[model samples]
Target: MCQTLRQKHNLTVRRQDVMLMMADLDPVGIEQRSRRRFVRRVYHSLGPNHVWHVDGYDKLKPYGLAISGCIDGYSRKVMWLVCGASNNDPDIIAHHYLQCASEFGVIPKLLRTDCGTENGTMAAIHCSLRSTHTDDLAGASSHMYGSSVTNQRIESWWSYFRKQNVLQKDLDECKEIWNTHTIRAVNQSRCPSGKPDAMYALPHRFNGRECGFCISQENLNEFFVELTRSTCGDGQLQAHFEELHAQSNLTTSYTWEAGVENYITLKNMAHI
Candidate 1:
């Protein structure tokens, strides 16, 4: 509310002031929970792209849909969020991640995720990339870290997502909205562009580091092809994966015309 007032309305009200107004609007709902909870602890990261918290939200698993996303540790900006029927598939997860990296033009220095198979393919590539840096100055560390509670940055956003999206919504539309949504800076300082798009592109506004590092197209293609073979057959799925890589622009949409229905049906049945 404070961010909206500052960015959209050009008002100068403080966040505490907005909270007071909201409490007055709903006195009962504004009361704090009486239940005991863990003491709030804060974690810090060096800057944007230094660490990313990635996880899958499976509340829509029964409906053959799930969401996977990454959020920057320092800026609290979402790197990318993808909703799909094949969210459980390692290759699909890896593809969405690579596509995000391609669009942003750099993969993060570290990726933090729970120990899930969905992250297996991407984790392997991150490991291989780090291994290439035998020299002391390479400074390539493990891309993935395993701790769900430690990933509260992105985890906290899920609660609000659940509240706002009470019904089924368009996946692409949800992605667009999340990407453009404005957020308050860590210090609650007003940023000219509070939206994630601006925060990520202009991290300097928050005195954060700029995104640095670009992955080559060839390496991306190799990783996907290798991951595809490990997860599925060398037939239709492989062809579709290659076609995605061949596109001049990585954002081009491609559907698994051959096997998506069956895959989704089987996945949904497993949950049932």
Candidate 2:
């Protein structure tokens, strides 16, 4: 309305003034929450891949699908969104993290998440990367890993996810839709092309925040081997492990026994 008035009527009005005028015109129509006043807060990150926020959404539980996703802290690019039958399953969460790292050469320096049990596998994977985990307390419903206000970047996307009315469809299709959909740059650091995938590839456009950390091929193989152990049988996993190492030219110095021990240690420490 402010822009329309300025463009059409040679009238200048501030956006907040226009909002107040609208509120007076239809007081009941205005949301009470919107009317509340608070100091505006700003959030910033050092750079992309410096931190990532990962979480799961289970609103589609009645339809038997749950969504897990990660978003870069700085550029606000969504790293990946993975869907499965159970978002709470540790393996499902770990698989999505692994998949994101596979596509992007670097791993995040830090991951922030709530202390829900669903994050167990993701936390384990983050620790495996020698990355730090910043967590909200377990069962602390009011606490968010970072401030609730700061975490709004991805949480706001969930609102649009429901508005699109795509929740009832199959998981794979929903994942595809989200991955391809273009988001315009609301800030300067966002992709010039306004697509997450494009911005992800062109880090220079966002001030050189891309590909900061690369996981070794041997470590990648070990991670998947540990990840696939119970999920897939020994023969199939062995073949995959060897293939990954050979493809990446990584020396296979880490043993499966050591991987198991590392996983167990991380899991136990995560709870305490």
Candidate 3:
């Protein structure tokens, strides 16, 4: 509420003020929200990059597109948001993981995800990458699989993403938005309150340490070679959109409405 006021109205209102207004303007909502019960779950994280929750948002899948993303558990920063042909494809998912990790030159100490077949390749890749890391969660146990409901960070993101009716179709543009969204601080909780990017970049400011481990390009290359060798005989999903994108003469970003239009344009071109 405070953030909304500040951003939309350029007014920095107090939390108490917002509460009072919400009570008067939306009594039923406030009452219902107050009565909501939260199930107890004991979850802890060291800091940013300590654990990344990876998941797919399937609500838009019926439109012949898919959205998959990963969020840092501690800082609540979205590490990656990818819009593509199929979030279920292992190679595409793995590519998003590797590309995002490459941007930071490091991977999370641990990765939390739901037990989905689509996550198989990403799971194997994370474990393989963590082979030489000395963390407590390294090696075979580096990836933790759980139910979607319990994969809190990314799941929570999907909820908010839907609530906002995020119509921006450019994955990177959408990524920039929620990545900077402010998370309200809970009273008596140790979680920091601020924009995710700030907390992720400067964890020490919030009394947290950077928990990601640096990885070498050679390791990534070796794994890619193995991935290629293993899929040699199988039908592979090439990055056709990328090939089309280069020749499409389109800007790299688009609103959700614009993206749909541009997607059709590229799809037809690819078919041709």
Candidate 4:
């Protein structure tokens, strides 16, 4: 009778429901508590540009591609995706970074990556960026100069991508198909929190115009400076400001100063 019931009336369980049932069965209760704690930790660490997660994938044969993926920790958008063999090459990572900046027009404030050989080679790209090593009391300056931010959001995204998309059959054709489908799905899908989609603009009711507007340089500068100086200190925001200053060919001090000046000028001009 039990066997017949098990076979005929088996539960169609969702992942969360299974987890809840398991928690109810756990004798010590530690498993459920620990899992909850772990999830909360992950949620607390997420922020836009807070961390970038990267890994290499080789499940697809013949081509044997190595992939590095970057995700926006806050918006959960895939910021950068690059595929190539030779896991340890910095060029691959750099190429992806450039592609992201060109397409998205934003630079990540913090890059979170695993301790891979390619990611470990900080010298080449560090020199290219012209960021000087400071002799602060900290250990080797390399540690201070190179990308140091780390988080688990990227890892979670990787697990979802692997199980839901990458690890499916048809390994040969999965890359192109998965990339196109996943990106489109993510860009269009609404977040569970009811937040607006990050990739596209919201529709303005008055004019039916897309609400997305290019952030003016003057406003951007002021916003970043205020972010840096404000009490809600975020490392990712600081990193973004630095990256933008570098890209704009302005010194860090000059960037902040100019931003303030520009904001004032714009406001004054508006008054006229």
Identify the leading candidate in terms of lDDT.
3
Q: Tens-digit lDDT track for model 3 on 1-272? A: 56556654578788889889989999998888787477555456778999999999888878755778899988888888866557777776787788787788889888888988888888899998898877678898899999999888788778767744334354555566667767777653466878899999999998899999887777676555323422212233235666677777887544666666876888688784
Candidate 1: residue 216 lDDT (0-100):
76
Q: Which 10 consecutive residues of model 4 have the lowest summed lDDT?
A: 223-232
* Cα deviation of 161, candidate 1, in Å: 1.3
TM-score of each: 0.66, 0.55, 0.76, 0.41
lDDT tens string, model 2, 1-272?
Answer: 45446644568788789888988897875876455555544545556676678777778666444677777766557777765556676777777777777777677766777667767666776675663323332222212355433565567557655644333243334444444445654432333434455555666775656534676666665666344333323466546555554555333324434445544554354443
Q: Per-residue alpha-carbon lDDT of model 1 for 1-272, expressed as tens digits?
A: 56546654678897788988988897766665333244656465656676678888888776545678777766666677666555677887788777777777677767778888878887777656556555332343656566766667778767656654422244444444655766644332222336766666778776677544567777676676434333333366546555544642334223433235544444454453
User: Model 4: clashing residue pairs?
Assistant: 52-112
Q: For this target, which candidate reaches the highest TM-score against the unseen true structure? A: 3
Collision pairs in model 1: 111-143
- Model 4 TM-score on a 0 to 1 scale: 0.41
Which ranges in model 4 have alpha carbons more than 4 Å from their true place?
Answer: 1-42, 45-47, 58-63, 120-150, 165-196, 199-272
lDDT of 4 by residue, 119-222 (tens): 65433332223233222311232222223233455565555556433322323233323322213223222321212233222223212232111223342232
Q: What is the lDDT, from 0 to 100, of the residue 167 in candidate 3?
A: 44
User: Where in model 2 is the C-alpha error above 4 Å?
Assistant: 1-40, 131-150, 165-193, 225-272
Q: Please give the lDDT score for candidate 1.
A: 0.63
